[model samples]
Target chain A: MSVREEQSQPAPVEGGSSEEFETERASATPKGGEGCDGCDHRATKPRRKSRLPALNPPLETTQHWFIEAITHPGTIESGMRKAQKIVGRGRVVTDGPILDAVDRMRIYHYAYRARLVECLADDYPTIQYAMGADRFERLASDVIDALPSRKANLNGYGRVVIDYLQRGPGEDGGRVPNRRFYADLARLEWALVEAVHAAPVPALDLPALQAIPIEQWGDVRFTPSASLRILRFDYPVNRFLQHFREDKVPSIPRAKTTATAVYRQGFAVWRMDLDLNMVDLLDALLRGETLGAALAPLEDRLDASHVMAWFMAWVRSGFFATVR
Target chain B: MSARLGFPDLGIGIGLRTPHYRHILDERPKIGWFEILSENYMQTEGRPMMILDQIAERYPIVMHGVSMSIGSTDPLDTEYLRELVRLRDRVGARWVSDHLCWTGVHTHNSHDLLPMPLTEEALAHVADRVRAVQDLLGAPFILENPSTYVEFAGSTMPEWEFLSRLCENTGCGLLLDVNNVYVSSRNHGFHPHVYLDALPMDRVVQFHVAGHTDNGDHCVDTHIGPVIKPVWQLLRYAWKKGANASILLEWDAEIPSFDEVRADALRARRYLS
Candidate 1:
């Protein structure tokens, strides 16, 4: 009566171990001083006279200029110039005994982009792996500049990568191969992260369902788990994610629309492909439809036995939290 | 029995990094305490919170944050402050600490601990914010000296003097990171002793010892490898000067097993003796 009998294998549950998350966070360290997206442009431009800001500007002005300089999307000198143009002057940092002020300022500039890039990489590991480090670093650098982080928590920062990818190619536009595929992959990966962080809710069990009167079963509406994410993608990114997690070389399949169900069960996050019947049924149920109303659309696709089996599988998977 | 403001000297502790959660939970190693990155646990009610709930039940916890941005010109994030207090009560943490530098301004966060301009105006601004934060927490808020690569042209005093004045002005406690002192001294060409000599040591309730990446021209607070020899020496110097505070090792990058990291944190005990 379980879905395992209906599939080649049981739905795969990716272990969201703390070690895995720790490794993701540890990899977010600064990638040294390569500057931002187009750091190579710095070599061609000649160094200008130091335009350090006047001593002791207002704290607000200094913070504004410093934030502008470090996040300027270019070389440290260029960042300083950009900030100076905005502030009507330059020269905020004093030179150290060994390094010049610009060189010293570059540390913050490199770290700002590096931290954000690593955060994006952490959230979208499959994309980072597929794009390779250098290209991914470049894309991440551009995405960071395009979308500045406004929240105190970094967990929500990577949500913008999906929006950025969907906006078409970036500064190095055409170099981003298969934009739609990458966007879909980012969506799946972000969903996985969200599932890992989603709040825990008590799941409804068979006994609880049986506790309802038989006559009232038709009107029993089910509430989906808060961690449950039902995604419809243009590409089979779920299979690709499985392969990636297995440490196998994941190939980008040609565009084919697919539906996926990602949710956390206990400590592990599970990803399963959904057939048309399950997708429609679950979609209806998620919309607060009662059991009878939800199954009505699937009547042509599923028989009584099939419907009962699917309900058993979903209850076993902890997909629904409560029934009313 | 305790350091300043009734906060105990919990002896040697390590940062409660995500990598060591399982080991700490399963084996429940005998460590003095744990310093959690408050931002990591904030705004999430999932597995991390579950794990923290378990860990908090077993050990003494201190909440260390990175996003307070106390030195910024923007109004304090009252929401963040409220969540911080809630988290402290939930975990029963000993004290809450964050860096003295601002992270960003005007609603945009750089996420990097950018250095503060050590001017009189900046000092006054930070002191007022510190008072407000401490008042909100209804406890003595602790601030740590951050590692800086560049000094401000308008700085009226050295970093230690700024910290001393702020502690005097706000009645706040100090975390007094020895490694940050070492890193900043190396980066800005100041004697480490001179930096330590000026600090109000009794105000120091905690010490942070971490490894940094020495890029020759400057040292970045990468918190990577082992605590270097001179950094250990600096800890000894500060401890001798009456900083009876809890000591913690911060290993955020390439962290080893709990045994290795705990061993590294325990290394502080030798200097204390």
Candidate 2:
């Protein structure tokens, strides 16, 4: 099952009559205290009467209502209310012998939320660990509810988490702690996901660099790998991430401008912090600057040896696919 | 049992997941085939494609998707379909499969396989879409029965009837997931055998078997743990019903090691015998 199909369904009902119309309402009623796993809200309350009309709705109308009901940000009843408002229905779904209409619909409602949370959790495990499961789930739910997926694939869905956290406090019920720091952390994590999914390219090796005529180096424009990403942050979230990966929950540090490079080598994803001079040089080169022009801005800050060391490091890091 | 459309009955297999990637590459496990989630490898040309390039050379890979939204009223996504073709050609995949349900409507993808109302309107709509998809792929498009929770109040016929008619109308193939059938049957209070009996067994090109959570009132297709006795029995019954299709196991959550998943998948061999 893909992330979409991975939503764990609620437990099945026991044996019942196979007759289509046989309404075993006694056993079909949802048992009390039963909630979907990881879902805080359960449909234990008396469900409001169905608002869907008895007549067969058109396919478009049915889908619109169904999408609204399952994708509702709140409880299943609230989703139904939202669906009713959108499509003007009474209950369109049949209450089967095993589960009532509301209980049945709750499965999808909870599953949709659970599947997305799981996908984000996979990509942002450090954040999940930092916020604790409940808090992280709430934040993810808020992000998911706010930004419904527009693309067919979910690999890029977590892209919105960065903006969500940076949008400021009181926006998400204050569920997020250290909004700016978490935003940086999400940015770092999303970078890794992007790096892995990004196209892999061969780096200009030492021989390739040597092959480039030194006299022509001034005019050579370097081509960065498609997976290369240079990120600047107000927090040292990369260090925090390293600590978290080693099972050390370091306190979120104070804000400090940190420049980092995220790129992949073969199958391994690498993240390296950069100094101000290096950041300027790399940023210039990434903007299609030639060697001489890229270093001209940092000439005062970078000596001959400094340029040599940084160029060697960048070459070894597989950041540049070609320089010509 | 001959395949309906010459699709091979590759023996019991497991889904190609991330955790097992390293093991699959290092050991080159002796498995029948691997069913890949097509969307995972689509829209990206990174390590997944690199690894898939190597794996496809060694194994018979099948493409199972979740985002096609075949039953939606919205117009089909042409780019998505083109990418599917590109990936199928790139991977040399045995076949491409998605759910029989819709994902979302009006340009929004809920990402969850939402159920479709079993009505004449829906059946015809799906049939037309199936034809279009098949025409684009130039191959028989295979669809699996998604595990649905709610049945529409206005359903004019059962799901099996709808599937049978859809297959009859379009030259599509079926990836009969026994676990899904068992899960949906339990949820809807229908006998699993009754549901299987209604399907055109000859059209089934594959069978999906996996464990599900029995939540007392309804069975959720969690695809966790192992193949329970009943689900394997369902597979056995389907096999006995003459749907000689390939067998694939999907263990998405809490996935164990390749060897463990292989052992769990091999459990189907006994039932098939």
Candidate 3:
């Protein structure tokens, strides 16, 4: 079901005078109100009553109150109940009637939620396709409730989904089917997105690397491109993503260790699956290790010819920003 | 008619969207100008940015954003403004614009343009922010009237009055989105014509025309499909009132071919001419 349909309608609250409602709210604070309520202090602070003192102070006083109430990270009905206490009844008026005012607030509340969900859907298209529209939207809504967006950019909004899913639905008190696989998929997808938008760096051309003396090869350290990302997962997410991109409904493969590198080349993002040894070498190179040291650990396990081929392939793929 | 800010009317243009990127580059159709979503190309080194560089080289571009949050109580984001200035300078944008509403508070971004209370207090607050932004940008900052679903009970005046006073206070310009005016009017039961007539027509530097989804009693500003007759009528009304601002068609969802969207945008010329 759509989020709008899933949410229950807000019930109208009893109308009261501003002073009467303020006194009632202050009394209802549970005296101590024990320990923070875990709400963000910045978000839930009491409205500043002294900011504006007009004949109708309720409207001026309740401006931020209404915004905070509707965007309270809770159900719409609860938000309305909290907003009602701050503004009081019969004091709030709009160009439209009171009922329209209530409906308008509801629309804003739903629109905020809808936009967040839309961002998540765009950032994680593969996961959305796998989970289907309804299920993916439900998951997106739940993730949003747990971790509201703190950045001005929507592109940076859903970075926590992978970790959130890894926590195994503990918050929801339910098990998500194939939870591990889904988490891995989210990791790969998000990594690609980050790689695509990361800072651009000029790749070190083959001639530049060849110009270095043979004696300096041992001390030469390679700088990985800013758009390079090395991801390790327990599911074959790279293969799954390939099929998903091809518009085929492929079955989820059995659990298997998978290591992949995602990087941008010529303004296009590319993904490559690598063996365990190659993953280790790439990881070391990404950490600013010398070419000699990056290959030393894999020397005994792999043939010399294979190592040289891998090195040449990485350079051809434009993964190194510089070689010094 | 020249805008008070002296921004030239670049004639009818369309929003540069992703689906039409390949077609735009390959065909390079005859167009007046392009309005780019500032946030889309900011802080990115992706294909979108590359394509924008190519497009900006040939077309007149304007930067419109949603994250400026001008009405928020939070301190202005200097970093966002700096990047906006850089992007504007890089693209040689004619003007930079965002909505006259807050996107979030307390460092959180709702990504939706939330409504503002139409009061003297909000007017002063927003005017100050607009002046600061314009100073930082070293250009005239333009603001579009958002398609608001809710009207604040605390609003002491109509939206048109608040906008007019804001323009006067800040010396900023207006984008005058006619579809948004129509959408808000129907949602709040006001006359769209009165809303347009109340505006300072000379201050309008641009115009936005888009389609919306009409859901019985209320309408959602879904930039899909074609511009409706009522909204086109509103655009015509604004045009006759001497708002000779640059007109751009917005189609963000279910986008058709470039030819189709261009044709849709070209429809405005009939009313303007």
DockQ of 2: 0.41
Distance from true location, Cα of A287 in model 3, Å: 0.7
In terms of TM-score, how similar is model 2 to the real structure? 0.91
Residue runs of model 3 more than 4 Å from their true location after superposition: A1-63, A72-75, A85-99, A168-175
Model 2: per-residue Cα lDDT over A1-324, one tens digit each = 112221111121111111111110011101111225545434434456555476578999999988888888878889888788655646688767745687888888877777777677767877888888888988899988877778888777878788788775767634566888888888888888787778877778988887887789789899999888889999988778877766787887999998778887777777887766677878989999988999887666556765666677778878899988
lDDT of 1 by residue, B199-242 (tens): 98889899999888876556778788899999999999999999
Model 1 misplacement above 4 A: A1-10, A15-54, A168-175, B1-3
TM-score of model number 3: 0.87
Q: TM-scores of the models, in the given order?
A: 0.93, 0.91, 0.87
What is each candidate's DockQ, to 2 decimals? Answer: 0.55, 0.41, 0.22
lDDT of 3 by residue, A36-153 (tens): 1212222222232222222233323544555665576776557767766665554343424223444556666766666677677767878898889989988888888777877666
How would you class the docking of model 1?
medium
Best-first order by lDDT:
1, 2, 3
Higher-scoring candidate on lDDT, 1 or 2: 1
- The Cα error of candidate 3 at residue A255, in Å, is 2.2
Q: Which lDDT tens digits does candidate 2 get at residues B162-214?
A: 99999889989999999999988877878999999998899998889877777
DockQ: which candidate is best?
A: 1
